[model samples]
Target: MSHVTPALYATLAEIVPELHVHCVEPWCVIGSAAALLAGADVSVADVDLLVSRADADTLMTLWAERRESVYEPAGAERFRSHFARFRFPGLPVEVMGGLELDQGDGWKPVKARRLTLAGLNGLAVPVPSLDDQIRILESFGREKDVQRAKALRALASSPLRGED
Candidate 1:
C-alpha cells in the first residue's frame, strides 16, 4: 500500500468525525494525503489538514493530550501557521491553521479553491480538487512540491480526474 492503506483509512475514519464535531470552520485534507485521495500515485507518510485558525485552536485544545510537543514543522521561513501534530493509531496527523506561503513576494493565505469529497470506506474525506492541489504545490515552489504537482497534473489530465 504505497498510497493510503486500510489502516490509514481506518485511522482517518476514527479521527475525522471528532474534528467535524469540534471544528467550527471549514477544513480539508491537503499535501500528499490529498494527492493520494485524488488517485495520484504518491506515498503519504502523514495526514496534513488545512483549517481556520480558530478551528486549529479548538482542535489543538481538544487533542492536547495527543499533541507531539517535540516535533517541529519544517519550512518555517516559507510557511507560517498555527501548526500542531497529533498522534493517532496508524499515522501522525498535522494541522495547519490559517496557512500562508511566501514565495519571495509578500505573505499570502494558502487555501483550496475547490474541495472534492473523496469516499474512503464510509467517510467522506474532503480534499482540494486536483487542479487546486496542483496550484498549491506549484505555489510552494520546492523541488519536491514541484514533483508532486507534476504527478497531480498527470492525474488531472487522466480519465480518473472526476472519479474522486
Candidate 2:
C-alpha cells in the first residue's frame, strides 16, 4: 500500500490519542508527488513515522487486521497492512512508529496533531522528533539517506516558514 487513507488515519487515531508525530521523508514528499509524476524519478517507498513509543501497541492493534507476513530487516517484529497505497516506486508506505524501527525508544506524545495532508479527512497521527531523526541518521554515514534526514532537520528547525 502507498497512500494512507482516512480510515487508516481514524484507526491510527484510535491508538494514539495524542498525535504529535511529525511527517518525515517519503511522506513529506507526498504533497509533491506531482513533481515525480511530471518526470521526477523519486522513490516513494514508505512513510518514516516517528510516533510516541507509548502508542505503539495502540497503533499495532489498528493495523492488525491487514497484518501481512513480513520480517523487519533489523530482526524486530514486523506488522503490515495490505490496503495502504503507494504513490512512489518500490516503496510501499510503512509506519515508523518507534525509534528502533519497532523495538526501541519511542516518545510519549504530549498532544494530538491534526494531519496536514489532503485526503486524510482531518485525522490526527503520531511520529517522532526531528532531532532524533538527525541523530540517528547522523550516527551512520549513508550519504543519500542522511541527506534525506537533513530535510527533517530543516523542518524541525523551522516549524513554520513564516514563524522564522
Candidate 3:
C-alpha cells in the first residue's frame, strides 16, 4: 500500500495554496503542493502531486491537516466502488514522476534522487534531471512501467543534452 501521511498533506496546503500539484506518490504531497504556491505548473490527483523544485516552497506553518482522513481527488466519482490498491518498487517515493521547471540554465526537468528525497519535517519533493530521470526509469525492471515512466520523464526533463 502507498503510505501518505496526514502531516505531509497539511504541510502541502501550508506551502502552496494556489497551484495544482500533480502527485506520483502519496508522500510527495508536501513538495508538489509547494510547487504550486511557488508559481510552477502543477497537476493534482487524489494521491500525488507533480511540480518543479524552482516553484516549490518550504513550509512556514506547523503541520495542521492531520485530522483529514480522506483525500478526494476531483473526478474520482468513477472509482467509487474501487477498494484495492497497488504498490510498485522504487523510491518509497512520495514524489515519483518528474516535472518541468526552468532554472537559470534553461527550461529543464529534474527529480529528487533517493538520497535527497528524505527530509526532517517533511519529505522534500523531488524530480530528477531529464536524463537522470530516464536513466533512473530505465533502471526499473518492469518493462511496461519503464516505457510509460520514461515518456513522462522525458517530457518533463527537457533540454536534452547527451543521449536521451
All candidates' TM-scores?
0.93, 0.39, 0.26
| Residues 1-164 of candidate 3: C-alpha lDDT, one tens digit per residue | 02334543554434333332432232233233222322234332322334333222211012222212243322232212111111112111122233433323443443444322323244354333344444534443346436545455545555642331
Q: What count of clashes does model 1 give?
A: 0
Model 1 residue pairs with clashes = none
Q: Which stretches of candidate 1 lie over 4 Å from their true place?
A: 1-3
In what order do the candidates fall by TM-score, top score first?
A: 1, 2, 3
Q: Positional deviation of 70 in candidate 2, in angstroms? A: 1.9
Count of clashing pairs, candidate 3: 16
The sequence of per-residue lDDT tens digits that candidate 2 reaches over residues 18-43 is: 33342222222221121122122334
Stronger candidate by TM-score (2 vs 3): 2
Point out where model 3 deviates above 4 Å. Answer: 1-61, 67-126, 140-145, 153-164
Instruction: Give me the displacement of residue 30 in model 1, in angstroms.
Output: 0.2
